[model samples]
Target: MPQLQEPKLIAGNANMPLANAIARRMSMHRGKQVGLVDARVERFNDGEIFVEVFENVRGEDMFILQSTSNPANDNLMELLIMADALRRSSAARVTAVLPYFGYARQDRRTKARTPITAKLVANMLVGTGIERVLTMDLHAAQIQGFFDIPVDNLYASPIFALDIQTTFKKRMDELAIVSPDVGGVARARELAKRINSPLAIVDKRREKPGEIAEMTVIGNVKDKTCLIVDDICDTAGTLCKAAEVLIENGAKEVHSYITHGVLSGPAVERVTNSVMKSLVVTDSIAPTDAVKKAKNIRIVPTAPVFAQAILNIWSGTSVSSLFEADTLSPIYDGTYAAE
Candidate 1:
């Protein structure tokens, strides 16, 4: 069998820390010689994006790591320009690595005459000559269908399950996994099953964007520690409300494990005053200064998972296998309950 060529990991300005971390992991996995591709991605005075790859990526696979987070448009445009640059430079394949795929919530039109921006974003990428896409915890699974190229949606559930097991080890039996909304029950149930805990749902009605009309806990949480799970926490209104409802229903403590901390607007303040004890989010999107200053917020690095997924894809291995709790446990395994 021919040896697989090492992919050149490229970083965009969106999330430098995460990009560097993933590059390091890739190097470790492929031996010392493999490293990140030296590149330049910046903007002109008029805010025009410019990209240049210093090293030859000709006929080599290139993975561009970027998160369309805050200043979403600029970051997203930067990714498109970078991919175009690589494609024009003759790179064999360009896989976009979006940890927090922004505009994902706008996958569908909730109102009449509204455009499906998610499909537009997918179209933009395909138009840029990109070959594949790798992302984590997409807001809607159907968004993958929007792309003509192959798309791999990674999950943070395994990581969250491991953390939950370690944090609530002795109290596993009294722990409940919660979905802040009906749509997220599957994600919550998967995590709950992994730790052998019961599942709960937060039934909420939204009167308008960013406001919750009514909130209710659908399962018994009295005397139990609840872990609210979701993909995104933009504005954090739903999260805070769910935590409050859980507390009011007698949950001993409430915590959250969200994939993307799009903690925009008054999210920090809301979380600070809420009944939730802590908010754990993956480093899919770089946290804002406010998010960094929040006492209750904790960040879990996601580079390791992305690094492994990149390697697996390049090696023709199953990316879904990474979600099997037992398979990825060696990285951060801990006994969460007495067997």
Candidate 2:
């Protein structure tokens, strides 16, 4: 087989720190220093986005690391425009590496006249010449079908499981993994299975968006240390509320392992005052100043995972193997050795 071209990683303003970290980790995996491609992504006075790749990427394998987080429209536009530029510049392939895929919650129409914005976003990316997509813990799994190109949805369960084991090693028998709502039971179950712990579900009735009416714990969490698992913690209304209910339902302590921390609005304030022992989220979205300073909020770096996945994709190896139980332990333990 012919040798693959060295990957060219670029980034927009969505999450530069994560992009940089991924580059550094990938460098370690390759036994050399690999840096990001110098690219300019800016806006005009009238708010028009502009993109210019300073380095030559002709016939190169390109990956644009961008998260469609807060200021979603602007960040998404940056990714689209950047992809367009790379395509026009004759890049052999362009993969969109979205740490946090925005508009993913709108995967389906709940009411009449509602639009599936997730599909729309997928269309937009494909239209912009994105050949593949790499995202983490999509709000809905079906969102992957929206793209005609290859979509690799990475899971955070492995990372969370390792952290949970290390943090609660002595109390493993007392742990109970929880899903904040019915829709997330699968996600919670996966983590529970990974940790060999019992599973619980928070059955909540939604009054409306960002509002919870009532919540009930489906399984016995009495005196157990509960760990709530969810995809996105937007506004944190559901997450904080779930923790409160878990504590009230006799859980000894409540913590959360969320994939994307789209902690918008009063999320930080709510989490700060909530009954949760801690809220652990991945570094998919760049943490705001408030998030960074929040006492109980912790961020787990995903650079190692992403770097390994990218390497696997480039080398025709199996990306899914990275999450296999046998292989997951070393990936986050700082070893990051390939299987």
Which candidate ranks first by TM-score, i.e. highest? Answer: 2
Candidate 2: C-alpha RMSD after superposition? 2.1
Residue-level lDDT tens digits of model 1 in 1-339: 353567778888989989888888777777775567898888899999999889998898889999999899999999999999999999899999999999998988888999999999999999999899999999988999999999999989888887777777777788889999999999888888888889999999988887788998898999999999999998888898889889999999999999999888888999988889999999999888888889999998887789889988887789998887777765443332223
Clashing pairs in 2: none
Error of 2 at 319 (Å): 0.7
Scanning candidate 2 in windows of ten residues, the lowest lDDT window is 330-339
Worst 10 residues of 1 by lDDT: 330-339
lDDT of 2 by residue, 1-339 (tens): 465689889999999999999999899889988899998999899999999889999999999999999899999999999999999999999999998999998999899999999999999999999998988998999899999999999999988877887788888999999988889989999999988999999998978976678888899999999999998888888888888888888999999999998898999999999999899999999999999999999998899889989887777788888777567666666432222
Quote model 1's TM-score.
0.96
Every model: Cα RMSD to truth: 1.8, 2.1
| Clash tally, candidates in order | 0, 0
